[model samples]
Target: MSETIRRHPEAATLMSYAAGTLCEPLAAVVTAHLSMCEDCRHEVEDLELIGAGLLGSLAPAVGPAIRIPKRPLECEALTDAPVVERRRPDHLPAPIAQVYGLGFDTIPWKRLGPGVWHHRLELSAGVEGDLRLLKIGPGREMPDHGHGGSELTLVLDGAYADETGEYRRGDLQDADEDVEHRPVADKIVGCVCLIASERPARFKSIVGKLLQPWTGM
Candidate 1:
C-alpha cells in the first residue's frame, strides 16, 4: 500500500484542487487519482461546495450576474506532450498513456542525461509556483543536492526509496527545506513523479557544480 509513503500531501494543493483553484497539470493528476480515490475527489468537491456556499452567502445586493468571457480563458494548454505507454497497476490503476490527454498532449521524450527523462509543463490557469516532471530510470539516483523551496512528489509508476522504504504508484511525498534525502530509483523499473517545487535545486556535490549547467537545469 502507498499508505506508508513519506511526507504529506500539500494541504494547500489539496484544498486548491478541491476549490478548483489549480492549473491543468496538477489538476489532471488529481483528477486521475480522484477517478480511483473517491475520498480525495469528494474532499475536493466538498471544498468547492464550501467556496460556492461562502460566495452565495455574501451580500446579494453587491453586484450583477457576471458573464464569463470565453475568448479570454485564463488557462493555456500544456506544452510537454507525453507519448510513452506508461502503466500504473496500483491503486485505481490507470493507463497513463491514454489519460495524459486529460492533461498533456504527446511530445517527443527528451533524454536528460543517462536514463533520465525530463518534460517541462508550461503553467496555465490557477497554477502557482514552478512545477515539472522528472522521470528516473532503474538504479539511478539524482546528484545529491539540497532544496531551495518546498518540493512535492506524486509517484505515478514504479518505485524509489530514500532513507525511507520503497514508494509505489499513488505515493505522495512533500520534501521541505529541512529534509534532504538522496532518493534512488529502485533497480526494478524506473520511477516517474510529478514534482512541484518553489525554487531551483542547489547543488551540494562537487560533481554537481561541475555539471551545474546540466544539473541545475
Candidate 2:
C-alpha cells in the first residue's frame, strides 16, 4: 500500500521507541501512530528484529537470583475490569485504547476556550510527561506555541494544519523546540488528536500566554 502518513517520527525517535528507551507517554503516541501507519509499522518491526539480533550477540551473564513476588488475593478479581465497546467517529487506535481504557464520550473534557476542549490523561506513577486528548471545533485556531522540549501529536479524527503542513487522521506531527506555529482545524469538520509532550508548550499570543499556566500547556 502507498504511504498514507506524510509526517513521520524521526529514525532516532523510532529507534528509541523500539529500544524501549522513550518515556511511556511518548512511546504510547508513537505506538498509536504506528497502528494507523503501515510504512512506519514495517519500519518499527525491522528495528525490533535488529534489536533482537543485537541482543543475541551479547554474551550470557550470570546475575543474582530474582525472587518472584506473590500477588494478593484481592488483586486477583481486579483483573476482570469492565470494558466498553468503542463507537464510531471516536474509535481510538489500539495503543491509545489500551492506555486510556475509555472511549471518546467517556473522557471528561474541560472547556479550554469557546471551541476547544481537552482531557488530560494520567499516566502511571513515575511516568514523566503530559499526555492528553484535544478536541477542537471547526475553524478553531489552536494556541500559537513553541516547544520547550519535544511534542508528538497523532490525529485520531478529522484534520488540522499548521505552518509545517496539514495533518489528517492517522498522521503524526513531530515538533520540537525548533518548531513554532499555531494549528487551525479544518473548516468543515474540526479535529481530535492525541498529544504527548515532553515539556509544557510556550504560548506565543497574549491570550494564550495568559491561559498557559492554568492549561498546563
Candidate 3:
C-alpha cells in the first residue's frame, strides 16, 4: 500500500505531528494516512526519535522527589493468560474505524449537495477545526475553492484528480491557503475520502458559497 501511494503530507506537517504540535483534526487525518502508508510511518518515527533526543538533552526540572507505586507480580504464568483477538473493517483505516465505531455500510451519510454526501466527525470539546468523511458520486466535480488555512485529505477508497495530480487509495493531499482547484471523482468507482481542514473552505462560485453555511465545508 505504501509503494502505490504517490502523494503524502508535506515534511513540515509530518514534523509537526511528530513534535505533537499539529491540531487534533489535522492530526487525525495524518494518523489515518499513516495507517496505510508505511513510508510515511517510517519518516514520522525518525522525526519522533530526533525530537526525543533533543528533549533528552534538556536539564531536568528541580523538584521534590516523589515515590512511585509498583504493580503486584502476577501469579499466573504468561502462557496461561487468555489470548484475545480483535478485528476491524478492512475498508476503513484503523484510526477512522476506532473513531467511527461502526462499519462503512452503516455510516449515516448526509446529503451535502448533488452527488455529494458527507459525515462530520465530532472533535473533543473546544477543539478548533473540521473533520469529515466525504462521498462523491462518479464523475462529479467539486466546486473550485481555496483553503482559508490548511486542509489535509486522505483517500480511503476510490480516486480523485485535480490540477495537482490524481490521488488513489492511501494517497494524502496536503493543501494550504495558496492552493485553489476543483477535484473530480473517478467515473466508475467514485471516491470516499477523509478530510480535515483548519478553517472553512473559500468557494469561488455563488452557489457553492450559498451551500457552504449549511454544508460547513
Candidate 4:
C-alpha cells in the first residue's frame, strides 16, 4: 500500500496535469511532487485513465489535422556541457537533475538575500509561470507575501512551517490567491524546495518589493 501523504495537490490541479494543460513550470513541480508521493501518483494515474476514456469518446474531425514538426532536443544552453551520463544526487529528483549538467551541490546559485539563495530553471521561451529552486538557511523566514495567481511548492529536503502547517521532505504545498503566509525554514538544517509560481510574489514589505525585480521573485 502507498503511504498516505500529508499534503496533496487538489483534484482539479491533478486533472489539469494529467490532461497536459498545465503550464510548463507548474507541470515540472507537479511532476516532482508525484515522484515523492505515491498517493498523489495514484491519483494522477486514475485521472489520466479517466481522461483517456473521455478522449476516446470524442468525435473525430472530418478535415485533415494539422501537424507540427518536432524539434531536436537542445538543452546545451542550460549547462556548460552537452548531455552525458552523470549520477544525480539522491536528494534531487530526476525531473530536476536532468535539466542541468551539474549536481545539486554544484548548481550555480544566486544569492537573493541574507541566508537565502535561488537557482532559476529555464523552460521554453514564452512559457507561462516560472520554476526555481530555493535554499533557505536555518531559522530564516521567507518574505511575507500573497500569491498573484497560484503557487506550488514541493519540499525536496528539510522542512518549513507556515500558517497552513509544517511541511517536511516530499510534502507539497498549493497556495492560491486566497492564501497568504510567510514560511520559516526549520531552525536546525534549514530547507530546500522546488517552487512554481504563476506570477511574481506580492511581498508586503517595501524592502521586499524593492528587491523583487532584482531577485526575480
Query: What's the TM-score of each model vs. the native?
Result: 0.64, 0.84, 0.84, 0.84
Computed on alpha carbons, the lDDT of every model, listed in order, comes to 0.57, 0.77, 0.80, 0.76
Which is the better candidate, 1 or 3, if ranked by TM-score?
Answer: 3
Q: Go through the candidates in order and give the C-alpha RMSD of each one to the true structure.
A: 7.3, 6.1, 8.7, 5.8
Model 2 CA lDDT for position 135: 93
Instruction: List runs of model 3 lying over 4 Å from the truth.
Output: 1-3, 57-88
Q: Is candidate 1 or candidate 2 better by lDDT?
A: 2
Backbone collisions counted per model: 4, 0, 0, 0
lDDT of 2 by residue, 66-145 (tens): 11111222333534757665567244775555444556667778999899999887766666678889999999998899
Candidate 1 C-alpha lDDT tens digits along 170-201: 67665667777777897988787766656666
Cα error, residue 213 of model 4, in Å, equals 1.1
Query: After superposition, which runs of candidate 4 have C-alpha atoms over 4 Å from their true positions?
Result: 1-4, 57-88
Single out the weakest 10-residue window by summed lDDT for candidate 1. 62-71
Candidate 1 segments exceeding 4 Å error: 1-8, 19-36, 57-107, 125-129, 215-217
**Which stretches in model 2 have alpha-carbon errors above 4 Å?**
1-3, 57-86
lDDT of 1 at 203: 71
For candidate 4, lDDT tens digit of each residue in 128-212? 6778899999999988899888899988778999999999888889898889999999999999999999887899988789889
